[model samples]
Target chain A: MAFFAAVNNWLKHFAYELQGEFLLALKTIAAVFRRPFYLPEILEQMHIIGVGSLYLVILTGIFAGQGFALAFSVELADFGAKNYLGRIMAIAIIRELGPVLTGLMVAARVAAGITAEIGSMKSSNQLDAMVAFGIDPIKKLAVPRLIALIIMLPVLTIICDFISLAGSWVIAKYIAHVTTTVYLSAVRDRLIFGNLFIGLLKPVVFSFIIAFISCYKGFTSGGGTKGVGRATTESVVISSITILVVNFFITKIVFSQLKGWL
Target chain B: MIELRHIHFSYTDKPILKDVSFVVEDNESLVIMGPSGSGKSTILRLILGLEQPQQGELIIDGDNICTMKEKNKRKLRKKIGMVFQAGALFDSLSVGENVGYYLLEHTNMTLKNVSEKVVQMLGFVGLDAEEIIDTLPDELSGGMRRRVAIGRALLSTNPMIMLYDEPTTGLDPKATENVLNLIMKLHQEKTIASIMVTHEIIDALRVANRFIVIWAGEIAFDGTLEQLRSSDDPRVKEFLRPFLSSFTEVVQKRFVEGIATENNSASL
Candidate 1:
């Protein structure tokens, strides 16, 4: 009986937290359409999340792309299909690697940053102070981050895809002994509309996941400095896992919708 | 006016305020005194509509905020200003920006006009606005931060009442005197009522017109200064014992000064 009671309490608490998270995300989306847009805050967040994550995203793209080309070249060479390296790299990187890698990296970097900044604000009474001053914290703080992430995540994904393709081209020419012209043509051939759409779509979905989880963790943070640290870590972990899990579902949906197109 | 009638508040399974009730009439200076975790600050948060009570009504100026919508509560908030412990200034903003935050965000006042108003408020709080306007909050001393917070509170169009939570807990003697004097001056000049929550008996005695003592989530005593001084309640006595020596010293010093004045006048 004691065991059953404990399990029931845990289930109830979990359901409560799940409901809170959904409400927070919905309020944030509704806030985006509300008045008092806070345009300057939105622009500042765009600069931070977009410009701040550029170098890291670029580095991740280059290395992942080069490693994929190097590894796949061996397998293709075994089958005397080395010229297909470009086509394989392009499809993998554009439809999968580029968006997922960018999403995870951003989940680590931007999500942690957003959570820490907001958690500190919460711990310090700024959120209450904002309310006391008749300002909505969601409108003032969360909306800018959500809007900025939505705009910048897709842009970052595109940049990552192009950089990754560039990195693979280098490996195909120098390391794989595949002719540059053949590899380039093979990559161009795989750059169909379906792959491009999926690549862009994934990051947009990932953006909402990262923003909602991080902002929710932040606004709910308590205790103090230790609580802020705990929330930041939780934000990153939740966002990264959600992105990976959601990526698979998004891919499944896209594959079904664009059946046989590739 | 503010009133809390039979308010009951709880967090988790533990009650923080149990059947607590009080009132502060217009232009009244009411000091809430209690030990740590005695639900003193909780009362202030409840009055601010930051937390809801499990049962009872919190009426501010005639409206029962417990039943009001969030939008109306926010509109009502403009009538009150709060000063948090640690100052709670926006760390990212400069002193001037922090002081002028409300006017800048809520009004159509241009930066130039807001800057002027901020400068005026800084002077009102006895800070050098010109010298410190551009400095971040972290750069200021503890006393300066508290003063900036006061300035921010007063800068609201016209706050009918001010709520201060431990405003001088960590300040030095000089800073404490400055802050106490500032509170007194606001009472005299602006005629704004105030509710101050503090454990500092000396500061409370200096500023309060009446006192409400809370013990363990319940109101133990409520009365004027003389009533409190003459009370035989052991809980009140126990709460006052540690600080009675310092309080006695202040009274003794004033007595000596009064005698000196009498003697000097007789000699003349």
Candidate 2:
């Protein structure tokens, strides 16, 4: 009987948390269509999430690209397949590593900040004040962040993809001794429009996941200062895990359906 | 007009309010007093539709908010505003922006018009508008933040009902007088209906027409001033006995200051 009671309590708590997240997401969607869209707020979040993460995103892309080219081109040289290094590097960065790495890096950067900001607001009763003013927190706060993430993540990935290709070119030529012209021509030849489209599309979904999860954690925060710290940590971990999981399924679905495009 | 009927609320296994029933009419001030965690603040949250009771009906202006839909509840919320314990001003916004936020978001007011209204409201709160308009909320002292919060909520052209959660809990004596005086002045002008939740008995005795003291999630005492002064209930007296000496001294000084503050209302 005690075991059954314990299970009942656990199930109830789980259901409540899940229901809260679902309600938050649904309310944000409704808030989007309501009057008084906060355009200034949306623009502010865009600058913070997109521009603030630029330096880190660029550095991560460059390092990933350089490392991939050096690691594989060395092995492929023994088989005289080093000429295909540019094509492989381009495909890997554009299709897989670029979106996943960028998503994770942003999860680290923005998700933690979102959770920390919102959680402190909760602790200080600012969220309650917003609600009392007839301003829905989901609409005024979460929707702006969600919209910013969805708009910015794809733009960042496209930039990262090109920068990563550039890094790979430099590594291939200087370290692997591949001709710059041959590397550039091979990448241009192998790349298809469909792959680029699908690669960029992945970040849109990943970013939505990051924004919602972080905002949800923040809204649910309580206890006090320690609670805010915990929310920040949990937001990053949850976003990172979800991004990786979603990336795999997206990769499988898009690549499988569009095999002929490649 | 707000009424709470046999409301039951709890967080986890800890009960907050049990069978709490009360009614507040327009142009009335209801002060809820109790020890910390006696659920004084919860009453305001219930009224604002920020939290729903586990059981019972909360009717505001004839609408049963506990049974209402979320959309309808939010619609009802436009008639009310809350002042939090720590002011709860947006840290990212300037003092003027904080005051002008609701207008800027909900109205067709131009930026220049909003700025004017903000300045006017800040002056109403006895603040120097131009000096503080562009300053961040964090830059202000505790007393200033609370005054700015009041200025933010009290100046709307529409009638507003206000819920204050410990509005003067941690203020200096002078700031407390100013805030309490501001509340009285606002009340006198019929600018807003008020329900203030505080543990400060002097504030309750001075400002409230009706008072309710909660002890252990139940209303232990509910009475007018005369009834409160004469009540024999040990629980009620225990809460009041220690403050009897200081209450009169504090009230006299503050009441004098309050009258002086009212004379300055014309400047607003």
Candidate 3:
């Protein structure tokens, strides 16, 4: 009975948090519509969240694609199926590598930075100052980040997808001595627009998860400097882990439905 | 303008304010005097609606502030301004921005209008409006930050009440005199109720029309400055004796605590 009671309490708390989170999201959306457009702040957030993150994302993208292609080519050669390398590379890049890796990189670069900056503000009572001034810190600070992530995540994922595939293409054509014509044909036959579209959905969900969790952690950090550090670390770890888990479940659902739809 | 009745607050299981009660009339300046850990600051927080009393009523400006919703509480808080012990100025914003933050948010004033009002308020606080308006909080001296904080509080444009928590904590003798004078001038000119919490007896005697001394979470003495000075009460005598004998010591201690670390590091 005690165990059951604890479980019930946990479930109730989860439901309450979900309701509160939904209300917060709705309020934030409403505030964005009500306030004057802070275009410079949005552009600044985009530069920080998107442009500054490019080098890390590209480096990870290139290596992931090359590494995956090299492993798959070796395995295919052992099975006397080296011609399937392009198909494998295309499918893996579009279906999984591009979105998941981009999400993780963004979790490290953007989410952690947002959490640390806002957490420091909270600790130093700057957020309290905003509240005392009747400006919702959520509206001023969180909204720009939320909007930036929503717009930039997809763009980053697209760039990651393009670069990763290019890396695979280079390995297959130049290093592995695979003919360009054969590689292009195999990719054309196997890869579809739906696969890439499915991958595109992950970044949007991951972006929301990252921005929401990081902002929530930072906004609610009550203790001082130590608390800010803990929140920053937690934000990155939680966001990255949740993105991967959500990506897996999304991939399963999308591919299962796609199998029938196709 | 503010009344507390039977306020009971505790941290964990240890009580800080137990059945504390007081009243400050409109335009009246009330000084709360007590030694450290006497729940003096807790009373300020209670009045400012920062902390809710566990069992009591907090009435501010004829409103039941204790039970008000957060939105209503925020509205009520606008009628109140607080100067924290450490000034609590936003380090990220300029002095002018910090002072005019409230007008920018709660009013439809343009940047130009806000800047003008900010300059006027800075002048009222005796700060050079043009020189330090763009400076950050870290750029200002301790006394200047306190003045800017007072300016920020004044920007609300005649708050119904001002709650100051240890306003004279870290200042030299001259700076303390300036702050005490500003408090007196503000009370006389603005006609707003002010509640000041300080252990400094000189500060209490300088501006306070009435005094409330809290001892162990309860009001030990509540009356005029003359009554407090002439009272036979042992607690009042003991509290005032230190102030009377060694005003210089009090000033020196504050200066040492405030400036010593910075000077030591600078020399190194």
Q: Which candidate is the best by TM-score?
A: 1
**lDDT of all predictions:** 0.92, 0.87, 0.82
Top-lDDT structure, candidate number: 1
Candidate 1 lDDT, A66-115, residue by residue in tens: 99989999899999999999999999999999999999999999999999
Would you give me the overall lDDT of model 3?
0.82
Task: Kindly report the docking quality category of candidate 2.
Answer: medium
Off by over 4 Å in 3: A1-41, A180-193, B11-14, B35-38, B172-174, B200-202, B230-244, B247-268
lDDT of 2 by residue, B1-268 (tens): 9989999999888899999998888888889988888898998889988888999999999999998888798788878877888899989889988899888777888999989888988988889998999999999888899999988877542445888889998999899888998888888876568999999998777778788989888998887766776778888888787898876576567668777889889677
DockQ each:
0.71, 0.59, 0.29
Evaluation by DockQ, superior candidate among 1 and 2? 1
For each model in turn, which proportion of the native inter-chain contacts is also found? 0.67, 0.73, 0.23
Interface RMSD over true interface Cα atoms for each candidate: 1.2, 2.1, 2.3
lDDT of 3 by residue, B1-268 (tens): 7788888998869899988888888888899999999999888777766677889998887898889886787787788888877688888789998899788766889999999999999999999999999999999988888899999988964588888889889899888888888888888888888999999777776677688988888788999755665678787777677676564454455557558878888999
**What lDDT would candidate 1 get against the real structure?**
0.92
Residue B35's lDDT within candidate 1 is: 94
* Candidate ranking (DockQ, best to worst): 1, 2, 3
Decide which is better by lDDT, 1 or 3: 1
Local lDDT at A143 for model 1? 94
lDDT of 3 by residue, A142-194 (tens): 88888899889889988898888788888888767788888878877756767
Top candidate, metric DockQ: 1
- Candidate 1 clashing pairs, residues 3+ apart or interchain: none
